[model samples]
Each structure stands twice: as C-alpha cells, then as structure tokens.
Target: MKIGFIGLGVMGARMVKRFLEAGHEVFVFNRTPEKAEFLVKLGALRAKDIPSLAEQSDVVCSCLSMPEDSIKVFLDGVIPHAKSGTICLDFSTVGVDTSRIIYQKAREKGIDYLDTPVSGGPEGVENGTLTIMVGGEKEAYERVRSLLNSLGEKIEYLGGTGSGSIAKLINQYLVAVHSIAASEAMVAGAAFGLDSEQLYKLLKLSYGQSRMLERHMEQYVLDRNFEPGGAVKYVHKDVKLANQLFEQAGLTETLGKLAENSFSQAMSIGLSDLDMSAVIKPLEDKSGVVVKK
Candidate 1:
C-alpha cells in the first residue's frame, strides 16, 4: 500500500518505521520536517505538505498529538485534498465527538475514516504489539485490517465512529486513577517505614495488584526514571476528555475529575514532561518519602 503519514512524535515516528519495514511505499510528513529525516534515511518519501501527501497516497494515516491537531489535519488537510476512497487511519486519542465529526465528513467525501486509537506506549509501537481499538464502518475496517496488522497485534473493531476513542478514553481514565492509587499505596508504605521493594512485591501477588502498579514500580518509579513513556500532560488531557465523556453520558464526574486534577497538579509544577508515574511525585513531596528501592 502507498501510505501517507503525519505527526512524527515519539510513537508516531516509530509507527512510520513499522510501515516501512512491512514493505509499504511510505510518504512521511511532520510540521517540523526534520522529524521525518530518520524515516527519509530508511527509504520513506517526504511529503512537502499535507496536500501533497493526500494527493499521492492510497491510505492516509495520522498519529497526531492533540485533538485540535487531528481536526485541522483531516478537516483542513486530508479530507479536502485526498482523493475519494482513501482510507484514513487515525491513531490519536481524540474524544468521541471529534472522531464522529471527522468520520462523517470523510464519509461524505467518499473517504473511509477509522478512528483507530491505540495503547501500549512506545514499546508497543516498536514491537507491533499495541492494542488497537478501531471504530468506523465495518467494511472500511476490513479493507485495512491487513495494513493495521503490521502496526498492532491486537486489533479490536468496535461498533462505529468514535467507539474506539470512547474506549481509549475509558482505558486512559483508569490508567490515571490506578497510577495515582498505586503511587499512594507505595508512598504510604514508605512513610510508615516499610520497604518499598518488599511492598511492591507483596502487592504483585495480592488482590491489590494492577498493571499500573507493576509498570510504575518496576520500570519507572523504582529506577527513578522520570523520562516519559506516556507523559503526565497527555494523561491529563485524556482523563479530562474522559471526564467530559462521562458527563455527556449523564454520569456524575467524580473520580475522573479528581484524576484530571491530580494530573493537572503534576502539569502545574513542571512535572508534565515526566512519565505518568511521576503523578506520585506530588504525594512523595507531601509525605517526604520516595517509593524507590
């Protein structure tokens, strides 16, 4: 397939690599241009602009950073310029309304749009093991199922447009909540003079264990590696969007709001660039205890 890709951020850049590795003819573009250099070195063509990419490709894939970026790229760029019957796969995690609006707009143009939000971080991207949540027309999804297989091992097709983003936001909501809870438990243990390592080990085999607990404690928190896998600011945006989703669904926004605030607090104090596990930092500061081995 001839693939046009945009947004060359940490995960996006790597996903383009996957496309290239799978023997696809790839066109790469990023706002910065320089971010496409590595892929360019590996035989991917550079798109001078979004219109050029849209004009040249059979499939237009995007993995943008923000909801606004996704909208402007598709609404102003791809949807207007791309030919009919193009399949646009979006791996960004914008909310339901954003996805559905774009999906409808693309459908009107005869371009099939799939809101294909993904999880599993950079590791997932590189290893092609990401859990992909796909939402759009079932026929459209089937057409690109083979292409998607090159990027993700676990591809789940949800019902319709926006379903994927809805599911992704819900996943992120718990990711935020569980991150905080895990951090608190570890910190609380440390504050009371328990061994952080031993406590984490205990939690691993107990009912209190969670994937977030294992991820933070083993990979990030214990190693004191605050470098982002998924950053605080992104999680804040996701949980905030998730909170809005619940509110729109007529549920009271309680835990979601609190998680959003917690991540916001991480953002306000210059921890936004750190890993989501750094949500623990504020609590650590308050308790004067670190959750390191």
Candidate 2:
C-alpha cells in the first residue's frame, strides 16, 4: 500500500515505521520536520505539506495531538488536496462530535474517513500490539483492515462515525482513574511504611493489577523517572473531554471528577509535559509522602 502518514510525534513516528517495515511505501509529514526526517531516511518520502501528501497517496493516516490539531491538518491540508476515494484514518484520540463532523466533511469530498483511535501507547506501536477501535462506514473499514493490521494486534469495527471516539473517551476515563488510583495506593503504602517494591509485585499478582499500574511501576515505584508514556497535557485533555461527555449525557461522575481534578492539579503545578504518572506529584505534595525512590 502506498500510504501517507501525518503527525510524527511519539506514537506517529513509531506507527509510520511499522507500516514501512511491513513493506508499505510511506510518505510522511510532521508539524515539526525533524521528527519526520528520521523516517524520511528510512525511505519515507517527505511531503512538502499535507496537500502534497494527500495528492500522492492511496491512504492517509494521522496521529496528531488534540481535536484542534486534527482539524487543522485535515481541513487546511489533507482535505483540500485529497484525491477522490482516498481513505483517511485518524488515530488521534479526539472528541466524538469532532469525529462526526470530519466524517461528514470527508464524505462530502468523496473521501472515505474513519475515526480509528488507538490504545497501548508508544510501546504498543513499536510492538505492533496496539488495540485499534475503528468507527466509520463498514465498507471503508473492511477496505483498510489489512493496512490497520500492519499497525495493530487487535482491530475492532466499533460502529459508525463518532463511535470510535466514544470508545476512546471511555478508555481514557479508565486510564486516568486507574493511574491516579495507583498513585493514591502508593501514597497509602508509603504512609504505612510498606515496602513499595514488594507491594507492586503483590498487587500485580492480585486483583488490583492494571496496565497503568505496571507502566507506572517502571518509573514511579522503581526508578522514579517521570517521562511520557502518555503525557500530562494529553491526559488533561482526555479528562476534560470525559467531563464534557458526562455533562452532555446529563450524568454525574464524582470519581471521574476527582481523577480529572488530580490530573488538572498536576498540570497546574507545571508538570504538564511530564508523564501521566506525574499525577502522583500533586498527591505527594498534599500527603508529604512520596512513593519510594
């Protein structure tokens, strides 16, 4: 498949590489050229911009940051120059409303569009084990399934238009809550002088285990490195979206509210660029008990 990939951030960079490794001819672009340059060296042609990318590809995939970024890239760049019948897949975790709007707009232009957000982060991308939840026309999804298989271990057709976004929102909600809950648990352990390492191993063997718990245990409990698996700013956006979704549904989520507040507070303390596990920082400040070394 001749594919155009836009947005070469952490996840995007790895995803493009996976496609290339799968023997796809990949044309790549990024808002920051340096990131894409490395992939360019690996045989990805550099697009002058998204329009050029769209003009020369059968399929286009994006893994941008926010809703606004996705809109800007597709609207200002790809949509204008996309050939009729090109399939555009967005792997960005964006809002359901925005996904519907993009789907409608893409169809109007004779392009096939899919909201195909992913979970499992950079490690997942590298391992080709990311779980992809796709929402689009069933025909479009079937057409792109092979290409998607190159990048994901598990791919599910999640329905139409905004359905993938809805699924992604729910996924992010749990990610935020679990990560913060893990932080609180670690803080509790510290207060009781329980060995943090021992407790992590015990929890992993117990029902308290989760992907976020294992991921955080790497830096927070073990090495104390706060780099981005999922960044602080990104989780802040997801939590805010979850709150909006809850309000729109006329529902209340007190626990979700607390998780949002915890991540929001972490962002407030200038930890926005750090890993999502840095949510532990605010709780650390409040309790005066840091989680291990």
Candidate 3:
C-alpha cells in the first residue's frame, strides 16, 4: 500500500519505521520537515506538502498530538485533497466530538475516516504490537485490516464513527486514575519510611498490583528517570478530554476530574515533557519524599 503519514513526533516516527520495515511505500510529511529527513534516509518517500501526500497515497495515516491538530490537518488538508475511496486512519487520541467532526467531513468528501486511536507507545510501534481500536464503516475497516495488522497485534473494530475515540478515552481514564493512585500509594509508603522498592515488590505480589504501579515504580519513579513513554502533557490532554466525556454522561463528580487536575499540575510545574509517572513529582515535593530505589 502507498501510505501517506503525517506527524513524525515520537510515536509517529516509530510507526513510520514499522511501516517502512514491513515493506510499504510510505510517503511522509511533517510540519517540521527535519523530522521526515530521518525516514527519508531509511527509504521512505517525503512529500513536500499534505495535498501532495494525499494525492499519491492509497491510504493516509496520522498520529498527531491533540484534537485541534487532527481537526485542522484533516479539515484543511487530507479530507479536501485525498482521492475519494481513500481510507484515513487516525492514531491520535482525540475526543469523540473531534472524531465525529472529522468522520463527517471525510464522508462528505467520499473518503473513509476511521478513528483508529492506539496504545502501546513507541515500543509497541517498533515491535508491531500496538493495540488499536477502530471505529468507522465496517467495510472500510475490513478493507484496511491487513495493512493495520503490521502495526497492531490487537485491532478491534468497535462500531460507528466515534466509538473508537470513546473506547480509547475510557482506557485513558483508567490509566490516568491508576497513575494518580499509584503515585499516591508510592509516595505514602515512602513518606512513612517503608522501603519503596520493598513495598512495590510486595504490592506486585499482592492484590494491590496494577500495571500503572508496576510501570511507574519499576520503569520511572523508583529509578527517578522520567523520560516519557506517555508524557505528562499528553496524558493531561487525554484525561481532560476523558473528563469531558464523563460530564456529558451526567456524571457530577469523578476521579477523572481529579486525574485531570493532577496531570494539569504536573504540566504547570514544568514536568510536561516527563513521563506520565512523573505525576508523582508534585506529590513527592509536597510530602518531602521521593519514591526511589
């Protein structure tokens, strides 16, 4: 397949590499052309602009940062210029409303747009093990399944245009809430003088074990390395959008809001580029404790 890829940031860059390694003809574009240069060296083709990329590709894929970026890229660029019958897969984690808007716009152009938001990060992209949730016309998804298999080990077609966005937000909601809880627990244990590693080990062996706890403690918090798998700013944006979904469902108050606020604090405190596990930092500062090995 001739795949036009947009946004060559951390995860996007890795996904492009996977596609290139899988032997697809990948036409790449980025807002900053420098990011595309590395891929061009590795045998991917670089399109000068969005319309040119759209013009040449059989399918278009994007892994952008936010709702506004995805909206602007599709409405102004891909949807308008891509040939009819082209299938567009968005790997960005945006809200359901943004998904609906993009889907509507692409449908009007006779292009198939799927909200195919993904998880498993750059490592997953490299390993061809990303988990993908796809929402759009079933026929479009079926047609694209074989190509998607190169990126995802688990790809679920979840029905309707915005369902994938909804599903991804729920997954993000749990991730944010678990992150907050994990941070609090680790900090509390450390503040009270329990050996942080010992407690983490015990927790892993006990019912208290959670993926976030293990991830934050083992990979980041305990090591004091906050280089992001999922960055604080991105998680902040995702949880904020997840909170909006809760509000629309008539939820009065939720842990989603708390997770949103906590991540927001992490962003404001200049930890935005750090790992999402670094949400523990503000807690550590206030408690005068660092959960470390």
Candidate 4:
C-alpha cells in the first residue's frame, strides 16, 4: 500500500521505518527536513510538503505532537489535496472535541478520518507491539486493518469519530496516575532502606503491581537511566488533555490532575526532556534518597 506519513518524531520515525521494512511504499514529511532525509535513505520517499504527500497516498497516517498541529495538517495540508475516499488516520493523543471537529471537516471533503490514538510508547513502536484504539466508520477501519496490524499487536475499533481519542485519554490517565504512584512507592521503599531491585520484584508479584511499575520503574527509574522512552513533556500534554475531558464532563477532580501537577513540577525543574520516570526526581530531591540499585 502507498502510505503517506507526517511527523517524524520519536514514535513517528520508528513507525515509518516499520512500514518501509514491511515492504510498503512510504512517503514521509516532517517539520525537520533532516528527519525526513534520514527516512529517505532507508527507502522511504521524501515529500516536500503534506499536501503533496496526501495527493499521492492511498492512506494518510499522521503521528503529530499536538492537537493544534493535527488540526492544521488536516485542514490546511491534507483535506485540500487528498483525493476523495482517502483514509486519514491520526495516531496522536488528542482531545475528543478536537478529533470530532477534524472528523466533521474531513467528512465534508469525503475523506474518512479516524482518531486512532496509540499506546505502548516508542518501545511498542519499535517492537511492532503497539495497542491501537481506532474510532471511525466501520468500513473505513476495515480498509486499514491490515496496515494497522503491521504496526500493532492489538487493534480495537471503538464506536465512531472521537471514541478512540476518549479511549486513549482514559488509557493515558491511568498511565499518569500509575507512573506517579509507582514513583512514590519506589521512593518510599528506597527511603525505608529496602533494596530497590528486591522491592520491585515483590511489587510485581503483589497486588500493587502495575504496567507503569514494570516499564517506568523496573526499566528506567530504578536503574537511574532517565533516557526518553516517553518524555515527561509529552505525557504532561496527554494528562492535561485528560484533565480537560474530566472538566468538560463536570467531574470536580481527577487523579490525572495530580499527575499533571507532578509532571508540571518536573518540567519546571528542567526534566521535560527526560523520561516520564523522571517524575521521581522531584520526590527524590525532597526526600534525599535515590531510588536506584
């Protein structure tokens, strides 16, 4: 299949490589021309701009950073140039309202738009094991199932339009809360003089275990390797979006708000570029104990 991909950031670049390795013809564009150039050398075609890429693709897939960016790309770059019947999939974590607005605009132009937010971070992208939550027309979803399968281990088609965004927000809410809880638990355990590695093993087998504990704590936090798997800044955006959903739904407060504040503090202290596990640093600073092996 001829696929046009926009946004070549951490996850986007890896996904484009997956498509290329699977023998699909890929056309790629990025704000940074150098990122697109790197993909071009790996057998993907370099698109001068989004419109040109949309014009030539059977399926247009975008993994942008912000909802505003997704809006601009579809409204200004895609809808104008993409042929009728082109399927557009947005894999960004965006608000439900934003996804629905874009969906309506795409429908007006006869383009099928799916808010297909993904989980599993960059590791998932590299391993072809992402969990893709899709929301759009059933027929349109079936059309891209094979391609989605190539990129993920789990692909679920929710109801319509913004359903996928809602699902992804819920997923990210849990991720944020769990990541914060995991950090707190690990930091507390370390402060109490327990071996970090031993405590992690016990937590894994206990009721307190969570995926965040495994990914954020076991893999990165305990080792003190705060390299970016999913950065704090991006997770901050996602949690804030989740908080917006809570506010719109008339909820007084959510645990996501707490995670948002924690991530915000991490960012204020200059930890935005580090891994989401770096949220532990502020706690470490306050307690004077390192949650390391």
Model 1 clashing-pair count? 0
* All-Cα superposition RMSD per candidate: 0.9, 1.2, 0.8, 1.2
Provide the lDDT at 115 for model 4: 94
CA lDDT, candidate 1, residue 132 = 98
Write candidate 2's Cα lDDT for 1-293 as tens digits.
78999989899999999998989999998878889778988988998888889999999999989999888888888888999999999999999888988888889999998999999888799988999999999999999999989888999998989888988898898899898899999888877888888888899999999988888986555677887778988998997797788788887855779888888888888999999998888887777887764
Writing each residue's lDDT as its tens digit, candidate 3 over 1-293 gives 89999999999999899889989999999999999988999999999999999989889999999999999999999988999999999999999999999999999999999999998888888889999999999999999999889999999999999999999999999999999999999899999999999999999999989999988888888889998888999998999898899889998599998899999998888999999999999999999998898
Q: Candidate 2 regions off by >4 Å?
A: none
Q: Which regions of candidate 4 are displaced past 4 Å?
A: none
Per-residue lDDT for 157-241 in model 1, tens only?
9888999999999999999899988988999999999999999999999999999999999999998998988889999999999
User: Which residue runs does candidate 3 get wrong by more than 4 Å?
Assistant: none
Candidate 3 colliding pairs: none
Give lDDT tens digits, candidate 4, residues 126-215.
Answer: 899999999989999999999999899999999989999999998898999999999999888888999988999999999999999999
What would the C-alpha RMSD of candidate 4 be, to one decimal place? Answer: 1.2
Residue pairs clashing, model 4: none
List, in order, the clash count of every candidate structure.
Answer: 0, 0, 0, 0
